[model samples]
Target: MATFIKIVGSLIETLQKILIQGEIDEYENDKQMHCDARLVEMLDRLSKDVQASVKFSESFLIEKIQFLEEVKGIRLPLFIPHSVFLRLLKKKINSVSEFPIKFVNNVWGYLETVCAKVLIDQCGNYPKLLPSMKKATEHVMSKMKAKFAERVVEMIEMEKITDYTCDPDFISSYNKLMNYHAQFLNLLTSYMSNSITVEGYGSINIRHLSEVPENTRNQAFDLKMMMTTYWKIVLKRMVDFLALQLRFFIQKVVKK
Candidate 1:
């Protein structure tokens, strides 16, 4: 896991370097043209590398799960070990996949930071880049929706109401279920809060907008609005899903 994180960190660093160094040259001369071409090429290469790294990480995690299930004979439908769950909870979200929310958040953070730097450096000159940036943001939000769906499924499967009566083991399982639900809700709430905060720029970056020209402020505001909408929509969907799950659990408990 340490090695995987180090690899991801290295990829993010490379992406940062590419974004910083790939500045558009002002001169229209042949030398400037060559430099611009080279920078574009480098950016493309770095983007591909980052995508590949994310894919590799996802595959590694899946493989790890498969190993546990196949080799160790661990059943997926049963409750996950507390230690394993703790380790999973520690993972930072990635932008690429739905399984590890923290890694998704980290990836989005890096992308937004670099894209904001580019926007500031270019002073809103690069309209072409806006679509790509928006797409990446959208992709992360979509993955978040999928992540919530996955959580709902996992929670449902883990829930076993054989006897909701006062059996000691059943009581312990019920407590565990409640605890996991609370933990997930807390995680989602924290993610939403941080996302809208000034630091994360999951919403509008007022400071960044101030740095740009007045004409570009509208564009920046629009981008902010779009991001804010996505966040709200995804969060609402997650909340609704959790509520439904809670309703079912409550019904089961009451009936039993």
Candidate 2:
């Protein structure tokens, strides 16, 4: 019974090591959940920065309209060309795809700096080990950054193909944006008008958009609203996802 008890205790300890500390190293320890407060503060700031700043290209409107007009095909009345729309959507995605990767790089770059400081502070007692530890950290961060960047590209491609979300906000947001359709047209047609007030978007010059051909305007309006709504959803999800990735990364780094 004593022997069995020791065996069970040994097994539990081994499992703890595997599940908690993972592969032990200079950085790994039993407290898997431990993370520096600086990381938390940095992550919060990053989330706000991404949410506030990232958006689809403003020029996408003119570019897409031109492309659509160029690709405009003979079609039955009121039936939009799904293929053309898909291609246009892919183009928009491609244009905005780099933003996520850039954010990822910035995040990882900041993380590397913070982590280097951490190593310096923690391992100041052992100056000889700092070089190797810092090197390992950089190597790990680089690999993780590449992996994340690749995933972001894959995500953009997948979004290009199709997107589905159960969020009622999708429909709500689309309807709200489309509510401006008549107003948008009115503003555009008003020869004396310099700008139009758009909800969420502050007063903006319509002079440039006003020049879009009348024949193409309707489709352009619809496409713009749809893509705008989708971009909002995509950006929200990207931030949420990056937040999760940040946590996973911090935990993984801690475990290392």
Candidate 3:
């Protein structure tokens, strides 16, 4: 068992190294095609190891939280142990595919709401999450134009054309829409918190490395920068103070 764990851990570590280094290479050289092929190889190896391990013990949640954090997106962590899945299987669950399918659907639904809120905030259209083959940009732009046209019609109907900015009802309606979308986001959060996926394998939220776009990369970088600034101001100050106190305590211990 120890040997098995060691092997699996080694594989996971190698996979992580490859992914990290490949991402850097892709970013620096714009060699996404090469990176994508490497990613496919990595995924194939990881999946095979994961399946073999799961057959032996089920609930092995891989300890790679930092990697996910570095990516700047909260997702279903890979390398789940067989023991965890076994526990879920013992719960008399039906339909193997439903859980993962629903999990993906729910995640996409939550992402859609997030997109809507972001679009509204930026005065852009809520973009749909379609399959890789689908051309969704045009559809999203069209939808945004329609939404804006509808808003214009509403403004005219309300007779607040000149002073629409001052109309509380219009603002309230927009807020209400956002709030409704937020409710869906909350549902996803709740489901995740309750370990629905762990309990039933709802969806395997495996984000492909190839899917990381330039815009998303920029957003992730910006978010990390903001977080670093916040942490430096708050946590860093506390840590420094605590370290000083620790140093004084150690000196006292030495004197004794």
Q: Pick the candidate with the highest lDDT.
A: 2
Query: Model 1: runs farther than 4 Å from truth?
Result: 1-210, 213-216, 249-256
Tens-place lDDT digits, model 1, residues 31-104: 42233354344444434433332221212123334323343334453434444432222231123223224333
For every candidate, C-alpha RMSD to the true structure in Å:
26.0, 7.7, 31.3
lDDT of 1: 0.36
Worst 10 residues of 1 by lDDT: 53-62
Provide the global lDDT of candidate 2 against the true structure.
0.64
Q: Count of backbone clashes for each model?
A: 10, 0, 17
Q: CA lDDT of 146 in candidate 1? A: 56
What is the per-residue lDDT of model 2 for residues 4-44, given as tens digits with 9 covering 90 to 100?
34433443343334323443333354243233443455557
lDDT, candidate 3, 104-195, per-residue tens: 23323432343333223222221232221023423553454344334333422332111113333444443433343333234434554322
Candidate that beats the other on TM-score, 2 or 3, i.e. the better one: 2
Candidates in descending TM-score order:
2, 1, 3
lDDT of each: 0.36, 0.64, 0.32
Give the poorly placed runs of model 3, Cα more than 4 Å off: 1-215, 250-256
Worst 10 residues of 2 by lDDT: 30-39
Give the TM-score (vs. native) of candidate 1. Answer: 0.20
